[model samples]
Target chain A: MAVEIVMPKLGWTAEEATITEWTKKDGELVQRGEVYLLVEGDKSVNEIESFETAILRLLPDGPKVGETVKIGTLLGYFVQPGERAPFEAAQMMATQAQSAPSVTADAPSLSTVDPDPYAGRDKRGPKISPRALRVANELGVDWQKLTGSGTSGRIVEADVQAAAAAAVAAKVAVVQAPPAQPVAAQVIAPAPAPPIARATPAAGNATRKTIAQRMSQSAHTTAPVTLTTEVDASEVFKLREAIKGDAKRSGVSSVPSYNDIFAKLVALALQEHPALNASWTDEGVLQHAHTNIGMAVQTERGLLVPVLRNPAAKSLTVIATEAAQLVERARNGNISGDEMRSGTFTITNLGMYDVDGFTPIINLPECAILGLGRMVAKVVVIDEATEKTAIRKMMTLSLTFDHRVVDGAPAAQFLQRIKQFVEQPYLWLTR
Target chain B: MKELTYTVAAREALDEEMARDPRIFVMGEGIGKRGGNFNTTLGLYEKYGPTRLCDTPISERGFVGLAVGAAMSGSIPVIDFMMVDFILDAMGEIINQMAKMQYMSSGRLRMPMVLRGCIGIGGAAATHHSGSYYSIFSNIPGLRVIVPTTPADVKGMFRTALRGNDPVIMLEHKNLLSNKGPVPDGDYTTPFGQARIARAGKHVTAVGVALTVQKCLQAADQLAKQGIEVEVIDPRSTSPLDIATILQSVKKTGRLMIVDDAFEPCGFGAEVSAQVGTHGFDDLDAPIRRLSGAFAPTPYSPPLENEIVPSVERIAAALGELVKE
Candidate 1:
């Protein structure tokens, strides 16, 4: 028999956890209650234990320490050492087998039939087991007087015990009989499955709620001044690949996508252009001294901008790590609200979809929101004199700034700095 | 003294706090010789020694748990999770244990544990190591959550977290650690559960935290161009949320809009709306609205991720809906 190892809910909030360490080697024999692995959560670290003695079979080797292991993921297959276990076949059969027994037409009617058949239909009778009926024939407490508490409206031992106690309390003569009596069992019928209905309307309602809310606050209340520019993205893409490769070689699983580098560049650009790192406040232009950059993350659920704190101080490796984590949390619908708030400058990237550019709303109280699009190959004159058309990778940059806080010139300059950083990747790296 | 970034302000807070209190010490991964992942604890090792600025293995749960134990044993332990994203790696310790230990022990155990979490997304660390989760700690009963948007706030909040009796999760926005703000050299602590009226207005009220507050302030400035005046409130401490300050602002303005960078289905913005809807539902002239990150995981691609999160347009649009209502 194989016992399924499912993701344990370490905390009350969520079920998924990141596997940090695996204590046992694959195919090694393990005893019950032995520590198998260590899982990391939002709050604490927990050690998972084996409940059954078996051999371990871990798949997807070299699973990174911080990657999420979802609920119901098979951590490993349990099998006896030196013996082939047909756990897979059992699992398949279990899935195909009927969950509950079906009702047979030849069986007695469940709802309308009399609970007990020995007495007349008009006279209520106590339901008795085959053994209880024989015992009652000898002692004679009226079977009709005994009540039932069991399922299918049948009599149970507890009911008999209560009646006997009540008879004794009432000073009625007790009929002594053998203690062993057949107990009636309840027949449980399979529950009918509920009819399936479309979920489109509920989903549509949620979308409408979001749209209505966004339309009113984002469009009407704030004066959104969008600034657009095009930047060469060849270097940004190359740098990302290089970083990811280097990190992998070093045993540190770093997935620095192009967005991560853009975030870093924006953070640096905010340093150069402090005007863009501000939000318009009621107290008249509240200038933000620190540049907390927020990035837009697209998940199955909705759009979320998880801000990376103090990007200026961290290395590219650390930044890459943090960006992956935040985006993953956002996608999983597990990110907390605090992570979403407090972005001095926002970066929205739609590069992967191959879209050139689109206007993005400002993540208010921040002065500017940067929109990024797909990196495409474009013909450029390598040398003006030669007129040589060379294929160069390029992407569009759109900046939506709070006009009240940032003027068009500064906003353009912020985009210009972003462009320079992307083109000259080494400079951005140095910063 | 010198022009300092937000990270420097944090480092300064640590230095100053350590100099003032002999009982306070910092322990975390790469904090000693490496100066910390973000350099927020730079040079701290040399000044305080290994005992004070302790560095441990990549075991966040182990070290953070040790910090909680250390705190109850008479020492004030400041544990730094290299990144706020990584902090979730030890949520069990921070939330279930550190946050609830004192209360569970019926006040017999004094937990002076300060958790410094590096939060937010800017660098392209897709989905895992970026973004803020202050609400995660704030939602729990025993924890105090703080997100510092400015250099001054960083220093002030750090001071307050260190002195507080309960465990505090100090969320340090990663990108904000570098920009400079003036802070008093001596010592001063900003009280917890107080909202700073970053911007005052009469037409509408906007509430936010950390960088989102900055975004709301920006949205407010833009709204000013359209003859819309917005009052912006920043709750530095998320747990002991100052509902009074937020409600008062909403009552005076009659219009309320909440902008949060976190995902929107259920967030701090939702909490603000609930509080307003329940307390001053009649006083509100417009429907309370919240602008938050789209309900999704943060994407790695620039455009897709950008489209998914909350932006100025979204915040402004929500405010517009409220105004029209």
Candidate 2:
């Protein structure tokens, strides 16, 4: 008896579905409970598992990818070896190919299988067990994208354990990306650099494609506003000098960089001005509890922001140490997606290029981004009564916010607090 | 190598320890003069004299407490229970006082006592005489539980337990007393937490303690003939079980079977399966299988008793089903 695989009614209302992929070939040996093919309903894509163990024999009239068939229509059959095909040739050409994004609402979606099993899976994502699911969920592994190798091809607890080991391997792989040599190279080459062409067609690079899609998404959905302000950086320079001297006196090798100090101060300022530490949602605003700041680093691949979490709660030294490591890894291209995502706020510094604060785009879903410009010595009018003139350091701060989430005043207040910290970096150290 | 019965191996370990040290002694009901009901302490009574082999009345609680006191006073005492079923009578002395003595004394006092008992079902011993209580006792913090499956392990682990300065519960299976195997003439101690591979196979890893190890080896041997490779591991000591060996074997085999003489729930097999499931699940191809003594008390009928306890037939059949997956 050939077990008929019908087009299942995925939801109460959904009837006809398109057979998007065939996991097993027509004559492949198939086992019960093994995922055999994928069918797309209006609301969901269900991976169809075999109900009986037998050789899979697709009817010549079986539906193909992009062809929508009626509910209860036969998709394929599981037949005994040497069994004859019951149907003759039936090809219904696709009227239109409509491929929707497969990610499910609230729940994570899994594609059943393709003729090529690895076709739909993320090369970097891990397949794990149920307990491993909990472990990966805790350790932050995006599991649904992984292809499993467990019994009947389902992630098991051991797979999760292996995923943890795999996660370490992934991190080590990222770290092996050409080390700080590039960082040194970038610093040494002070040529009149042409702006890196953002729209140059790279042949078959998937990362560039993804970056284009993400940037388009941000630009499409966000109501972005850019605000720029110049702050007195004399106090910040003196604070950095004191920190460097104290660190040298104590035999500390790494002193807090200006970016590290700003990142820490911005996180704390965001904490005080909670309106900026949020995400845009249809239901309401998602007020994030922790201050995870993503610092944008230009990598060999593209611009990547490696997030350092809870920067507001961390000490200045800790922030400097962690931020330095994150930037180094980002540059090396060894940073995991888990480290790249989970950001509530972001900071991009072009101060290194002597950029006088260009309008950096908001890393969308996050409310705002703060851009730091190069600090330079300038003549300032001091002692207003005597009309005396003296030298003072100044830097530009550009804050880009999602205007829909926060109004001008709160955004301005958040930037002002950041400005106050920039003027008096020692105020944060005392706290 | 000398072929010795399990009983003779145990007696030899005690005799060797007693002769080597003046403070070493044996105390249990009907152990002296009669030389133990199972004859495991047969010649120890005569060799050590009445003072060293002081047999007590049928009072496990009192005798166990007195032995704990003897251990506290710098004597290495070996206390035997006529049957593991009666261990409940001395739970306070064994679990609370003796198990907690060293920690309570802040390491000042060392209770080097060995509470030896016979477990496992056969001979229609019924519920009272047949009980695998080591798993229950192994739960205590300060106590180390050991079960020897062969003459070699019996002799070796016995020597280790007798010499070490910690409370060790040595559970010898009643049915294995008459079984014999080759034992080395010289002194050798099998370290705790080290598992011995009795028969190596590739399809599944089977773990057993005490007599179940023998049964699993027999099963493994039979399975090998059927073209199914089964790896049999004997965790000579249960409490500090040789889980690493089991996990490694499972990593290779991806299938696991545990044969135990203890009841299924919370038994040594269950614990081993759990640890492997938590830590080695990635290596597992199928759910862990545990073949243990039935939850019911050992029936008085010999056939029924044999049916309840894990057997080679049951172990092989379980592995056969597992291999099919």
Candidate 3:
């Protein structure tokens, strides 16, 4: 029996993701829990792990960077000892959607709706979902008209719901409904009216059409959870400077970023907190055997997360070289589909854009995501007894996870492990 | 192996390559039985039949894309866009797709394609056709760019391009096609990444490519009569630019003047001048003089076009000025 690999749903609003790199070759026999590929989605790169033990048989074709592969297409095939093929709900949905005609051909066009749910989400900019934007767009409701009610005044579903209800009521009051003469009102409600185009320039720039579908699927099917914490990066800064002269002597250009150290720390932490590095299914929790870390790259086309496989196994120099090459390829538009389909966990750093902190969307089914913030220098009073003040680097770490599988204590402990690694990064070398 | 004219040399490259390799073919407007607008493919249609010597619609975008797709599929395609300015119409395929295809594919596929276009100003080609735009393609990566100043080079470079694995933009000077030289009477391939010293000198190193290389040679002859030893370097390939030869010449001369028919800003002259200033600045006795086309599009009037771009007189004056400095 051959199993077709479909595009994985990442969040409530993410419809599609860019393939970053393939960890396993097409002919390689993959164990159920082994890391398979990397995807750039939800503004971060994530490692997609194998769900079943099988051989990867095929790879899809598309542009390296900007081409958007529709969901449910065959990423590859898997042969097994089974008598029949397993049901791929995602692949079926994608095919049925492709073959069957759309509902709202004559209705208002949704062509202008931003395709990417994570569109307009700069590290320091507004965080809005593709769903909320779509609903707002469908009814010609202006996003600027509704005040945000979520964290940091981000417009959530409720805001869209409120706007939709208000529009519905206004329509009911002004326009009279005609006497019923049709067989049914459901079909007449308007085949999914082509999404409406929002007038905002920011919305136009970041819309990913595939992002909308995956996000809708994730929200409808998966349970989401989030966790948050504060991590001090004072020591990370010190260690980076300490290695600068050494890097120069070795002919390397610059020191690895704090995010580089944090990526390694997160990988180490996931090993100890295996629960956080897994997928929750009806059968059981799938714990990944190898850690493939995905780094989020914000490109001109959209957000693509390319993964760095077994980052923990490689030295910092190798990690730096791989990371730089992956980022460049993603920008140059050369990543493959197998690379974007499978990922275990994700990390998104907004420090380069000077943002303080943010709630990153969970790349779905996967347990958690790490959100990094700008590292700011602050004065700290080390001891009240001595009355001595010390300057240190401080930053916020936000972890959004599915609480159904992981408890708060375990999540905190995992974060603490990450903090320890960040503080004493040289310990990674010893390991 | 026959006596091929500069134009015929190009036609033979298409004819011989198409005859030798089934994968090789020619596609361009008016390049079929009608020959080429410039007679570069004068007799290819009857020889190879229409399928191999295909005539394309006057759509630069469509033909460039077709050529790109053919190259990706392992076919050797010789695409003639008629004029270099026509390349601007298909810039998306040329720069975005063709230039980055190899690197983007992680070295998976090689684009074995050749883009032939006529450049330089003459015959009242107007604003659209009269352009010396070699710098535009040279500055970009993944494209092996070359400028052939003589009849022999046009044949040799085209032969090389037909055989090499990389995509090549063969910049043919409109003014130099008829100016014949003692070309080899047999199959020949001029290796890319090599610079030719047209004239040997010691006072200053003067460099140019394409029609401007000829201008520099003429300028060198005029200056030589006045006891000025001027070295003229023609870097046939611009992208795999023979910077070593250019720098070596500059290092010996202690002064330099780059004469080119292209504009000064972001032009090849500016690049050469900067390279000399940064790489061999210590060896300089005077500031580098860059005599280039005026910062304007090539005009329609022959006199105006001639005035805007570098001429033999302007190049000689620039060389004289460098010596005086």
Candidate 4:
């Protein structure tokens, strides 16, 4: 028999839960009592365990990451040795709902998806039930011959039996070592004269699609301007060196990466310039107290900005250690979408890639974003009194602020404060 | 090149290999006169005569043991187990002796024997006869599992099997016996662990073996009309799977789905799915899908029997999901 893996009804008031990550993918065998998936409800992430040992079949178009699906939704199925999923019509509809852009369709962000038959999913891969497999094996059933009426065209046991009975009635294919496979081939290999096109870009995943919509919204709605400034990063570099040594002596286990500096110092600057740490909402400009700095990391999955909560309050080493773990989790695709949401501001560094300066769009709902460029040694005038020039470590900081909430002057003042903190790391401790 | 059925192509491979190697011999039930169960060895009996083509009693363990001993001695013996399902009759000899003897012998002895049979669910032959066990046989250490999808592929792979110096088990799909296609003339051998692209498309790479290959192609065709292109790959052999071919195809297509005529759990589809999931993950835009045989018994009733086999509609549906916007 098969077990129904439904969305858990966490609390009486909780209406839905979002599936964070499926620890075990579909078609993988899972043992009883083992956590096979993770779901988030009421801000708490829960590992969902399998009640029985079985082969898993996840609903293909089901709730993706960041999608908050209703409770009791058919998340997937777990079939023991040889059992078929017992999903009814309503549950089937819920599974097929993923066929529609489950993320963009309901988000109200993208109004109408381009109506190309090419836009949505088309019929190609078969979804055969366990009973269907054995029945096909028992009767030498050709899988391609039957169309499933099940959810997303899954081949139920009934469909297999109907296909076999229909074949027997057709007289073309019957019980035997398939008489003259030429006749059988007619049923199996339909006229595959040629293909339409061999190369089309696969549909973008849910996360990337969400990123696209949000970025588009941010670009379309916000009146943003970027202010660039070159600051002497010598003090920040020395600070990093001292911290690394202190971390080594204190057994801190984590010497913060250079990016962690932006998370730390930019967060401190936001605390002083509270106007910069605010969002331009429809109601009014909402200011925030906690300085949660989103740190963006690039991965093949996509660009993920995991929020480092209260970076200003936490020690540099603590922020660095947590940022490292969050980045790893984000890269490994296990970090929850919640970790990416609700940031007061964002700090992205392209210094490692040797990029000088590039304007960064504000992550939606956040008022400003700070982009850190590569720190390079350049000959510069240190003192005009003696006309002295020296080689100093310098980096370009590009801060894009929402003009709707803050004017150019305040934005520049915010940038200067960051520059001041960058030029002298000792000021933050003294303040 | 000559147009030939899967049966005749398999026979030609046997005939040509035996003519090339005088030490090769054939043994099975009704193979000498009645032309074996599926007619793959129809004419070899008359052409090679009794010594080279001998029909044995239905004692699977006895004849299989003899074939292994014969292989250990010198001659290359190609034995047939009427049905892969009936292989249970000689499980001890096949799983233990024939599969492990070479490893134990080290460099001293070799077992260049072949166990040929028809696999896959078909003919409403009930549970006992219609069985697809390629995934099970692939688990053994010393066996090279080769499953051919087309007449041309069967001709090429069977020759490759005949030439290899290991215990090669070649499975012929029951539904494809009469399927006809162009077979290349003269010395041709389809290399093992190399996948064949049955059909090419841009969207999804759907891999199938033997019977399912045809299903994938058919599904690909249906998807093409709908403007969703699906690339179909046939890893002609399973044990030494041509994962590179699959990976390259996936790298191009950005999505992968495997169709196995066997059961889903620990089936050919599951193993291949696991392999690509780990290695070709970054290249994929969608999660890997496996359209495997239902994990139920091969039932007696035709309707119930057909339920377990993955079909064209299912393949196209899986591709549809993979190609979804």
Candidate 5:
């Protein structure tokens, strides 16, 4: 028996994936556990291994490399040597020039009978209601190619509406419209310039398209409010320097970065303020028990957030090592989907690029995100009681939270706790 | 606004009309002293005297013919058939004489006659006492058929019927005689050919008549909980048949289901379905469905009678299925 090989599902949110490379070609012998192909999905590349050892028989009309296909699409077949593949047999039957056997003959030709009887019959087009047909025409949708979700497989008006909506969404993804102006605004606004002859723009890759969709969805769904506060990071800076010197003396390789420290502090603060570590859902607010902090890492392909599971429970050294590996894997575009999901909160740092304070879009389901800006030496009154002016290391923290989940006062309190952690590291680091 | 029962509201219309126009009189069995069987004429006999609220024997055809002559001879007579099924005996007088009086006389003679009756199958009324044959009168050329469901509608439509010069047939559901609702004070008349959107929705359009209008409203409420909204429309009159309102609703909803307590064949449901199918062809997303009484006659047993008519559950299920299409 020949085994059919199809595209595998990569992630929960992945609808399709592109086959970047195929190691085994046609007629190549493959063994179990051998990497057969590399598929890119959810902004990461994954190796698909062979489940059985057999001779590879690649389909002639299969998807080419870099061509994206839907999940479960048939790609090839693994068959034993000297066994005819399914498509090969069909092609041979077509080229044999065999006519239907004579009905009056003594023996009937069984080869003329189709193995799947239903495949040979004439298929009727989709049954569409008159209203749906009118709507499809008005919306310029192709009704014949659509599958109806109506009674007795009838295409209805709602199905047409959905197809129209999907078409508009695909157009938006392909156009990659300006981030400032929405699609609807662009449609209603007058044309800024006359049409000019230009080459066709390149369509965005699957990862970029997915990012655009998620960012747009988050911007639309969440009522985000960003609160900025300048914090004195002199204590956190000193704590990191002392930890680095101790690690160097102990011959420890991993030294905690500002993001790793912030992740730990945010996780601890979330433990105290459970509302900030909650998800806004239709049923109710989901207050996460374990603090799975997601550290946003900008990669060459796109932005990827690798989650650190229960970082609050891990030691500072263990968190530093794990965060370094997660960030490295994300930048290399080889992180698994499981390592990038189920985050309770997210922390994005742009301090290296000299970003001061900016409102960040909330990752969906997660309620709040903390953005870290660059730390600078600013002259300030170090002691208000003595009125002594001194140079202090200060950083601006921007906390963006969904108002629907937590009110202003609670979110501000959570941010205040984070500020306390940064200003006085001993308050949480000792525990 | 004042709350009144369906019977009291309709009686108030007759009282106001009879007091305003001396030529307006009511004639029915026991209507003079007994106030009719269903209190249709309640205490009006003493107020209007024997001449206006005259009592008559159990002769439907004879009195219907007498009222037809009175209507042609400059009198607005109201012939009250306690049960609408009794009007079958006077079909010839209604279809040939009453319906064709003004048309036959080339508009020279005005036929301002009000034929009022209690209709619908409920409370073991059986076939003889329970019949909603407004469709039959509606099929005729020159008759205004009104089947008002709410108390306010009954009062308002009855005022219109009493004031119009055309012959009008008012069919009041026996099950809704005591249904209380707010009615406007002072003069109010609901015009014929106008339909009321009993409940506004967006998923499915349901046009109901008589008792079925109430049933559809209940079904709409039930379906709303399930997120399947059903728009219930009550065509107050069958002759004019407010196809415009029904078409507009179908245009919005794209699915249509007609519920009538009458029989399926040649019933009010069939008539509305035909009109909507012809006028609102492109607006329909599903085949026009009719949830009506069974083809059999109204049974006497409670179970059998209940099984014949469309209940709220059946209407809701049908609407749910229609909206999916």
Candidate 6:
């Protein structure tokens, strides 16, 4: 018997997916667990593996590369060598006749005359109730290919409701994956001109679309307030230089970057002001128990934030090594969906681009985000009594918080603690 | 509030109405002096003399015809037929004269008569004694057919029946006569065309009448242990069937099952299933199912008789299957 292969449900909320590529050609003998195709759902590419060890028989009329299809749509069949696939002989006959072929030979037997007494009524198409059809239309579910669990194999309202719930779960999965773009690029990017009459905008890829949707959602849903503060980074920079010197002497390959040091310091500051590490919900504010900080990395595809779990509880060396790997995976498009979920706070640094004091959008659900500017040398007063000046390293920190979650004073106090940690590294690092 | 048996509660309603009205009287065999075969008129014979609690011979047809004439003459007659099966002899008087007197008289004369009977197949009551023919009376145009299950509903509905001018048929299930439930202390009347949600649930809606209502409640309890909640609805009256309440429950649960101890063909369940199918079609998540008594005569054997009607276990199992769909 030939085994039918269909588009699998990627996530609970994923109704359809676009086929990106097919690794296995027609008649290719593929083993179980071998990647045969790649499909994109909710801006993420997922590799689909063959479930049976059989010769692949790609259907001539099946969905092609770049074609989007609903979940459970039959793509092709896997048949044994020398075994005729389903619909093969019919297609050949239809081609010869150049007309619609009669279904006498392959038509399903009437349930009353069928030898299998326990089988349900063999209908030509899905048997759905009026209520189920209404609900399916309302939820935008393709119910034609679904098997009914109702009596006498009839689709009912409950089945449609379950499908709608699964689709919602898939949408939630996309929301929790990644968020936001590079601050410098966002500031410099020009708005597109209004289209002329009858002119259409160019359709972008799934990643770009997802980024646009999330960025717009964050902007519209949040009551944003950006607070910028100049931090004297002389001590924090010296602390990193000393660690780098020790690592070089000890032959340690991994050295903590400023972002990693800031991630640690921010986690400690968030611990003191726990409200900053919380999410706003209609029910109440959820104060996260662990400090999972998301580091925004700009990749070729789009912006991806890989969350580092409980950074406050980890050592600086571990955070540096893990952050390096996470950034590498995210840029290479190898980061799994799980790695980008459940972030309590986010940090997007534009220090490498020589940007200074740029506001960043808040990554929602999270209460606040920290944007770091480049550290540069500036003349500052060393002693107010003597009126003497000295060169010190200064970096601008922009904290964008959702005002609905925390007040201006509390958010400013949290930023003050972060500045205190940067000016005096011993305050938090010693603990 | 005070709790009373179904029989006692109904008797109290009749006794209270008889005391309030001098024109009201009861007629049945062995009821005047013997105080009714089911203790229906227990002490009413002494309070209201023999003229009021009048006894007649074993002639259902003769007295039923006389009650129709007496009702036309401004007297309210309460006829207590011991077994509902015996009323089959007086079907002509009930369906034609008693059900159409007020309508035929152009509202000039009133037919204020209450026909009470014991109906149900239990206690080994053979084919001759056991019968539930509420569906036949409900089909008549001018008759009000009430089949109350709980003691509270029986007492309350009985008051409404006596006060109304239309002829009413009150069929009390034999199995539910001794079942006890709380009744309101003072004078109260349960209006017709309203249903009671005996138990609230979300998974499946089970609409039952009379004995089936009690059985569905028991089945609901058993199904609750398995996390399968079943809502039970009792349409207290058969003629003025409260289909709105049943429809609302079906909308919430999305599934419906009608549990009836009467026969399946043209039975009360058939009526309810048709009404719900027409009015509440979109609310259904499954086929409207009817768990009714077998289409056979009442048997003499206890086990055979038990097999005809739906039991608690059968109702629970049917509800479990309906909920899965």
Pick the TM-score winner: 6
State model 3's lDDT.
0.74
- Per-candidate Cα RMSD to the true structure, in Å, reads 35.7, 17.8, 27.2, 24.7, 20.8, 19.2
What is the C-alpha lDDT profile of model 3 across A90-130, one tens digit per residue?
A: 45455656875575777555543324434324322344444
Q: What is the TM-score of chain B alone in each candidate?
A: 0.95, 0.98, 0.96, 0.97, 0.99, 0.98
- lDDT (CA) per prediction: 0.74, 0.80, 0.74, 0.80, 0.87, 0.87
* Candidate 6: Cα lDDT at B309: 92
Off by over 4 Å in 2: A1-431
Q: After superposition, how far is residue B259 of candidate 6 from its true place, in Å?
A: 1.2
Supply candidate 1's per-residue lDDT for A24. 72
Candidate 6 lDDT tens digits, B15-70: 99999988889998988889888888899999999999999999999999999999
Question: Worst ten-residue run, lDDT, model 2 chain B?
Answer: B281-290
- For A83-188, candidate 2 gives per-residue lDDT tens digits of 5345421221111112444435764333321124343254324434444455554554545556666444656545555666676555444432322344434444
Docking class of 3: incorrect
Candidate 5 residue lDDT tens string, B1-325: 9999999999999999999999899998888889989999989988989999988888899999999999999999998888889889888999999999898899999999899999999999888887889878888999999999999999999999888899999999999999999999999899999999999999999999999889999999999999988899999999888899999999999888989888888878888888888999988888999998888878899999998999999999988988776
TM-score of chain A of each: 0.51, 0.53, 0.52, 0.53, 0.54, 0.55
Q: Worst 10-residue stretch by lDDT in candidate 5 chain B?
A: B263-272
lDDT tens string, model 2, B1-325? 9999999988888888888889998888888899888886887777878999898988889988999999999999988786877878999998899999999999999988898989888888888998888678777789889988888888899899888889999999987888999998897888988888888888888888888888888888888889999988888887787789988898778788888888888877778888999999766767788888889977999888888887788889988887654
**Structural similarity of chain A in candidate 2, as TM-score:** 0.53
Please identify which of the two predictions, 1 or 6, would achieve the higher DockQ against the true structure: 6
**How close to the true structure is residue B313 of candidate 2, measured as C-alpha lDDT?**
89
Residue-wise C-alpha lDDT for candidate 1, range B1-325, written one tens digit per residue: 4567889888888889899899998888888878998997888888889988888888888888888888889999988886778787788888778988898899999999788877765566677876778766677998888887878778888898888898888887765777787877678787788888999998789987777787787888888899888899988888889999988987677778887777776678888889888997745654677777777778888787667666777777777656544
Output the lDDT of residue B97, model 3.
Answer: 92
What DockQ was computed for model 2? 0.05
Off by over 4 Å in 4: A1-431
**In candidate 1 chain A, what residue range of length 10 has the lowest lDDT sum?**
A178-187
lDDT of 4 by residue, A253-295 (tens): 8888878877888888888899998876544676664688898
